[model samples]
Target: MTRAEEQRDAGLLDAFAGHLALQRGLSEHTVRAYCGDVLTLLALLPHGPDGNAPADLGALTLATLRRWLAQESGRGLARATLARRVAAVRCFTAWAQRTGRIATDPGGRLLSPGPDATVPQVLTAEEAAAVMDTAREQAAAAGTPAARARATRDWAVLELLYATGVRVAELVGADVGDVNLAERLLRVLGKGDKERMVPFGRPASDAVEQWLAARHHLLPQQTSDPGALFLGARGGRLGARQVRDLVHRSTALAGVRDLAPHGLRHSVATHLLDGGSDLRSVQEVLGHASLSTTQRYTHVSTERLRSAFTQAHPRA
Candidate 1:
């Protein structure tokens, strides 16, 4: 592509990113992924008459869209990746057509493989309790003020993760004001910037209160984001990566199968369903956009039930 063509594509991507962020309310990570997919699709388009520049949006036909997906499949991309790419192109084409850049939305007719059906890994309720207990034990054993603060924060993190089933992003993104300790509720901004109130248990609330008491130990002289509900060693807002590391470390200490923060989310959802929480209620707490997404926990519950039956049934 010529320099001018490359700049044009860059400008298009910039505009599309704004649309995804401001209009669609997608998260920054998702905006980047969608933009990257669209960029790849644009690069794969047939050359224009100049034979150097890539074809314009006008060339985004259904055939070209399908060809892009076929090429990605050939590259051995996962089904979920392909599906996201399809969504990206469709979003792009619809925007292009609306803005008069393209006469038609070719991506409208395109299709891709569905998301993978593999079940997520989760800890049993007993295992979850063990993880929380381990975190509390670590806090109690800490000898120094800084160590105690960090350990207390980790305990709070694990308790909140299991109690609310909030995504790691949501937990890390929360502020001090977002928590209602007295009411045992947390306000989180979920994917798509959707806000929801999730109720946690007393254990989580008490852990958070303990961490709050010790929070100043980690506060740096020049702290960043002092209002953050959770703080790192440097006194900045807690990050998703830090939360993930804590989850892994705590699980290992608990002598359980190590899982990421997301696995903890899965474990909470499964436990809730197992304990007789309705699907709609779980959906609301988890901030799932679709009820169908919440239904996956039901499958996990069923699998557990089946395993127990096979192990204990006399008929077998």
Candidate 2:
């Protein structure tokens, strides 16, 4: 529409962001991410698109794009981050083609970044318990000694995430009314706003009930309420930032140096598989839109075989 990244209309990025917001109903965060991803590619362009090369939107080639990605790798961007950038580029070019800005996407044949294949990091069981304990103490010190009750809430959130392997975004998006405590199920709202109801074990159920009984202390109203299962101190509703900050701060206090918000979700799936839960079951609990995404949790094949050989062979 604007002459193929021609005039550097400064408003182009904002326009795309607005389009994402209005047309896709994407969250502000997502719109920004998409825009950022596209801008990153534009920055990598030689002499830019409109003004310079127009053959392929500034004659950007697959090799050129790969070089940009390689530069990103050299700069020490994490594999996951680089992968996201690739995906972002792909999405942007697709959008460009769809919107008729470019006849063909330069990113169409671009290869995905290599995956790091590092077993995703996570908190050990004891470490997770310690983090929960720390959060409880903080909540208690903040006001009432409602620590156990508060801890009950954190534990439910932590355990359910770990046990069910759902994303923090999904967990925070859960609603009080959506959770069927009697049935031990929580309806998780996922990306693209897809919904699924996942069942949890008794420990998670007990913790959730404790939180529910004390829920009024956290959320004082239900009429026209936000209906979120989790709440922040100010008490509107909890957000992913709050959840990540909660985990980060609590784990730091407990000295679990490598914990992350998604770590608990990773731990859940890995633990389930370790405890002999089938891969399909783990995949479903994780709400992985695909099975391949869930397979990363199967960190046992090589390690397990080594352990079996070492134990059974006379070499040891």
Candidate 3:
């Protein structure tokens, strides 16, 4: 492939990615993953017309895709990674066929091993309480106005995370009007552009109230759109990276295992199931599109129960 052909291939990939983002409603993170998988396959194939880049999607074949997967496996990629690659290729092939770019989908019969069922990390109630307490203490001991604002915001961030089990994107995407203090409810726009209302407890509500009262400290002095629920030091909408950094810092201060926002989400779902919340209810709260996706937490609950029995029974 010549440089021009490579550019065309790259442009096609970008077009497919845009389709996934706008037409398919996939989140940016997911779209990026799909693009990465496709790019890996493109890089593996022989060069195109100019012997510099891979051929176009219309030239793809089942043998070509299988070879790519086999090569990845030979290189020691995980089952999950291989499976995701297969899915990405299949999605792209189907799109190509639909768009008249191909006569048939080469990845129609492609398959890979299923991912291993690994349990996600979950924080116990006591551990979660300690995290919150640490954030609260930080807020109380703030030496400056900015420090106090951050401390308060951190507290609210943790509380809302644990209370609602919302993803980091949803938490940061929230607007000031999305929260209802009196009703203890939050309107969240989750993945796939789906909207759901999740409830929080009194502690989360109180923390948010404190942050709301003093949140202006974190906002820019001459802000135009003042409806963001959370703000950075520069008063812009809080990005996902900042929220992740804050979670890491808070967990470190509490001297507990470091947890990402999704880990906090897992903790809440596991705790809810442990406390007798039905699987469907947990699914609804987590905004999962399928019950099977939510069923993994049951395994966590079962493992915890078996562990308790092993420690207490002592019959062995």
Candidate 4:
């Protein structure tokens, strides 16, 4: 493509990203993923008006979309990755059509392989308890006030994560005012800017309260209120990566498998299902858009029951 064409493409891509973020209300992580996929597609395709490939949405075609997927498949991309690319293209095409930038959506017929049916890793109730208890013990053993405050923060992070199953992004994005300690509930802004109130048990409430008491210790020297529920050692808002590391460190200390924040979410959903919480309620708690997405946890719950039954059964 000419320099002018490349610049135009970049501008259009930026506009699309802005739409995804401000208008569609996608999370930052998701918006980044979608934009990355689209950028990759643009790079792979031929550029310029005379080229067979499209340089803009108006010139895009179903064949071009299929060729893009074919090239990705030839490059040995995973099925899930290909599926996501197809979705990204479709979303962009739909938006372009809606906004009158394109006469028709070229990705209307685009298709990719379905996702694998692999189960997500989750922690057992015992494992979850052990991790929390270990963090609590560490907090109790801390020597300095700063160390104790961080330990207390870690305890609350794990407790709230397990108790409410909020995403790491949601947890880190939370502000102090969002928590309702009196009611044992906290407001979380979930995907697509949808807000939901999640309730936590007394244990989580107590942990949060303890952290709040010492929260001032972690405050930056100048800033009176950082406004973030969690904070880093330097007193700025705690990032998602830091929260993930905290979860990993806590689990390792407890001698469990290395699990991410999402693992806690999976664990909570599975445990809820195992304890007879209905699928719909789990769906609501997790903010899943579809029941089918929530139903995957049933496999984990069912396997646990099957194992229990097999162990106790008289005749095999």
Candidate 5:
């Protein structure tokens, strides 16, 4: 039996996910979703060819696959849930055939989900202002130098996120050298480890100045060394988890419950469109590989329009 024949279905799914991570350079979340889709397939198939022999996933047919999906739907999976699963299987089957694991691709006929009609959540100008105000105020409350330095750091973090619309991972992954304060630009390593230069506005530049000036006061030990742009309490390189917690802490202190860092990112895109920024530029700033992702903000804009109409219109 061939290597594909010898490996169990679960093992193959894991290997495929690894391929996505190592070769395709996909992020952890995308890898997980892909693995999960194959897992759903594995569960539907009968257990193994014995350990030494190749497992017969070769029997996958359009009918069996459709039936499996139908069962999944019957279990009350949402349209989006069903849609992702279909995508997962399609990706796997394509890969499997290309890699010669399967002679026929099962996903050639798989259908995609309908367009996502749900609107994305976005913060209003007032709420965003409130959150920023609270962060600045909290930063001010800490009388110690270290505390004040942290406030500067937090402000920079919030400001950049709000301005650039980059994901939290991209933000924390940024090195000190990647920030070009003079040019008002930030270099980010986004999904797939792709590097891109994104620009921030004056507010973010001011925040960066404060953060950098006080940065030495915060991590005075680093005079010659240049590393991650953000540092944690330990003065070492900051991790993504810490940044996430930092945003969460600021939100909680700001009295905004159920708010996520991405909300601010979303706000940036929405606010830009609301301010007459074009869809293409918003897409570029957000590092979206597809304009379709950025187009979601238009839906957000429409909802805001409807809201304005409801509040302002004097209809009977």
Candidate 6:
């Protein structure tokens, strides 16, 4: 595309990003992914007579959309990636049509493979207990107040993650006021900026209380958000990456398969189902917008059941 065309498309993407964030309430991470996908799609549009690909939103025809997906498929993009890209394009086209940037939404007719059907890996109850135990042990072993405080915080992080199944982002986004220790409840802001109250067990509550007591030792450093429930060693609001690293480190110390924060999320969901919690209640706890999303835990539970029956059944 020409310089002018590139500038125009860039401006369009910026607007689309704003709409995604402000109007659709998409998370910052999701908005970036969608915008990047759309930019890639635009860059790959067929070049026109003047040696510049058409920059007009109207150039996004059904054929063009299909061809873009086909090229991505040829490049061996995974089914989940292609599915996300398709969703991004569809959202763009719908917005374009609504805003009169295009005459029709061609992306409506575009089809791509759905998300992968693979079940997410999760820690068994035993492994989860081990992870928590390891974290607590680490905290107790710390000699210095600073090290002890940080360790305490990590213990709380793992306990809360496994206990409530909040996404790492949601965990980090929470503030001190969001916690109701007396009731063992945490207020979390989840995807699309939706808020919910998730209850945790006594163990998680005790860990958080200990962390709060030691939190000041990690503080008196530069930070604007003092009310943040979690803080880094440098006293800034804790980040999602830090939370993820802690999860991996804790799992490794526990000698279990290393897990991310989302793995803990999967574990909590599966364990809840295994413990006889209803799908709708699990869905509410996880802040899932769709029941089908919550239903995946059922598949995990069923798989576990099948494995047990195959091992112990006499009929086999």
Best candidate (score: lDDT): 6
Name the better of 3 and 6 by TM-score.
6
Would you estimate the TM-scores of all the predictions? 0.90, 0.80, 0.91, 0.91, 0.82, 0.92
Query: All candidates' lDDT scores?
Result: 0.88, 0.71, 0.87, 0.87, 0.79, 0.89
Residue 191, model 4: lDDT of 90
Instruction: Show how many residue pairs clash in every candidate, following the order shown.
Output: 0, 1, 3, 0, 2, 0
Task: Score candidate 5 by lDDT.
Answer: 0.79
lDDT-wise, the better of 3 and 6 is: 6
Best by TM-score: 6
| Candidate 3 per-residue C-alpha lDDT over 124-201 given as tens digits, one digit per residue, 9 for 90 to 100 | 999999999989888889988888988899899889999999999899889999999999999999989999999999
Q: Please write out the lDDT profile of model 2 over residues 1-316, one tens digit for every residue.
A: 2454544634556666767778776656677777776665676665533455422344456777888788777989888788888987787667777888767777889888777777667666778777766655554555563555566567667666655778887788778888887888888766656678788878677667767777667654553457678776646677778777767766778888667778778877767776678888877787787887778767644466578889999986
> Candidate 4: TM-score?
0.91
Where model 2 places Cα greater than 4 Å from the true spot, the runs are 1-10, 14-31, 45-64, 129-151, 220-224, 252-257, 301-305, 312-316
- Candidate no. 6 TM-score: 0.92
lDDT of 3 at 120: 65
Better of 1 and 6 by lDDT: 6
Give model 3's TM-score versus the native structure.
0.91
Better of 5 and 6 by lDDT: 6
Give the clashing pairs for model 4: none
Clashing pairs in 6: none
The worst-scoring run of ten residues by lDDT in candidate 3 lies at: 1-10
- 1-316, model 5: which lDDT tens digit per residue? 2444325555777778878898889888778887867766766665554444333577777887888788777888778778888887887888888889888997889776675676546677877777777876776677888989888888889888888989988888789999999999999988888888999889789888878887866676644544779877667666667767777787777766546778788889999998999999998888899998888779878877899899999991
Please give the lDDT score at residue 217 for candidate 5. Answer: 60
Question: Which sections of candidate 3 miss by over 4 Å?
Answer: 1-8, 52-54, 74-78, 311-316
Q: TM-score of model 1 relative to the true fold?
A: 0.90
